[model samples]
Target: ISLIKKEIETFISSYNKSLQQKDKNIKISDIKIQKNTLSLNINSQGIFRPHNALLQLKNSISKEFGKKHKLGVREIKINNYDIQFDLEKKPLKNVTIPFADVKFKEKQATISLNNIDEEFLQKNYIDRMINLVNEKVENQYYEGKGEFWKLIWESGEKKPIWTKDPTEEMTKLDWLKQGPTKGKWFFRPQATAILKTMEKIAVEEVLKPLRFQEIIESNLVPFDIWLKTGHLEGMPGEFYYISEPATRDVEKWERFVDLIKITKEVPLEELEKNISTPAAGICYAQCPVIYWSFKGKTISEKSLPVLVYDNTAVSGRYESGGRHGIERVDEFHR
Candidate 1:
């Protein structure tokens, strides 16, 4: 028993060190061998899932303790660690107080009303309610799309025209509908020719005349880039995240391919459990990646303003609602 405990402790220390090196916020809080099972209690930071971490650890354990060993991982328990919030900032305070007997579990806190003034609290509470109402009204007004159009154009003050007429000529444009998703579509020869013509006109007549130099850029932007640009902070759920496969584990890839071939169905939940953490976010806009090119460099006076464009840039965005047509799609070329 002593020898087993020593070996376990050494393995745990090495595993914890590896996790630290990888900057993962997970560690085995406790481990015990009962009968033939090896139970591990994982303590992770707030909201951090240990799926990938545990997967790697399991692989490590399998290699360390041979495949024939009787050790099996049945449960993975996560205990929440206390998070400290700044009280001086006067964060959102809940007004409702339960009348029933409140039983505090692992963590306990005491709220004292003795020093707080009743009249002052009431006044602030009313003020908070008013502010909340004002905020909601403002949000609704801004978020709600209003009828607006650009009437004035370069060719004098001409108004845009639209029609919903059902004609054979117009209906023929809808030749392709074999897109994998609702917002994506496959353009047939007819539609493709028209699209190519429009692209040529837009480039030759509009962009080329303006001396816009086209440049090709990657569709994937590192997660850290978005953080530095403050876009992720503004719209946390707007962009699709990209994850890489466990390329080092060749057997895992083979197993996945075999599973797909046999089942003819994707095991998304299983894949999610085993896949690595997202390394980058899909390009939400072309401009963000363009800025990345100028990183770690100084601009001279001669290069006052950089003029560049990317016709081949494909952007992806996760829209929560208000999707009408192909104009607003999950993936689009700008």
Candidate 2:
């Protein structure tokens, strides 16, 4: 019994080390040992499904004791009482991923200002041009990119009858590197009585921080931000981009900081049964460990998207079935 206990201790030590390496918040809190029965308790910062962890434990026990008890006579009970994830927001830094879009509007209103002795007409025309420019800019933002047009007025006037230098807010054009145009101009004279302006800048910035916030908040997509460790069974984003063979390969992981929709949870039991299938292969090992049981019960699920199995992504683990998790030391007790 002592030898078996020592063996178990060694294995436990290694297992605990791997879990720690993954930064899994779970820890071995209690252990009950006996001749044929053993129970291990762990605390974690929440899991997608507690039962998945239970199943992994079950498999580990069976695999460990299979040499002597092929029938899988070992039982396991893993409890996660109060697990909380430290999902605090980080500092805001500039990112090149174009998370936001910028739209700038420029207006150039030009009139001959010749043979016209009226100021209201000129003012009205300039105002109208400004409105036109604003309209064009707003439309472009919604309708994609277009020419950053300009309207210039020229006449017999020595200085080419001009209105107040319209463009006041000179947005460092370079700042908007992705902008459609850096400049545009048009020159004409009908002697309407209005004047022209050099440049009038109107810009709008749209930033999408919680891209997935709308879906979750409106319940349009049933998804949650898992700041801890676990798996997301089903997400609506899966259907957006389908894959060959099945949906597993097509499914994309929308992480804790992603925006997604919760469609349903994938049947983990079915996945376990068919570990060799292509779909399973895609979704398998999604996390270092899966949470399946909540207080020792099961729930009917449909789909899953995000999985938190590993805090660190290893180069290659699938080809070895986590053999890296095991180390055989030269120590035998018989």
lDDT of each: 0.61, 0.34
**Best-fitting candidate, scored by TM-score:** 1
lDDT, residue 21, candidate 2: 67
Tens-digit lDDT track for model 2 on 220-284? Answer: 11122211332233222221111233234323222211222342656444344423332211222
- Candidate 2 residue runs with Cα over 4 Å from true position: 1-3, 46-51, 68-80, 83-334
All predictions: root-mean-square deviation over Cα?
A: 16.2, 32.4
Model 1 Cα displacement at 109 (Å)?
18
Checking candidate 1 for backbone clashes, the offending pairs are none
Q: Estimate each model's TM-score.
A: 0.53, 0.23
Stretches of model 1 off by over 4 angstroms after superposition: 1-162, 165-174
lDDT of 1 by residue, 242-290 (tens): 8886565777667667779999999786577567898798888888788
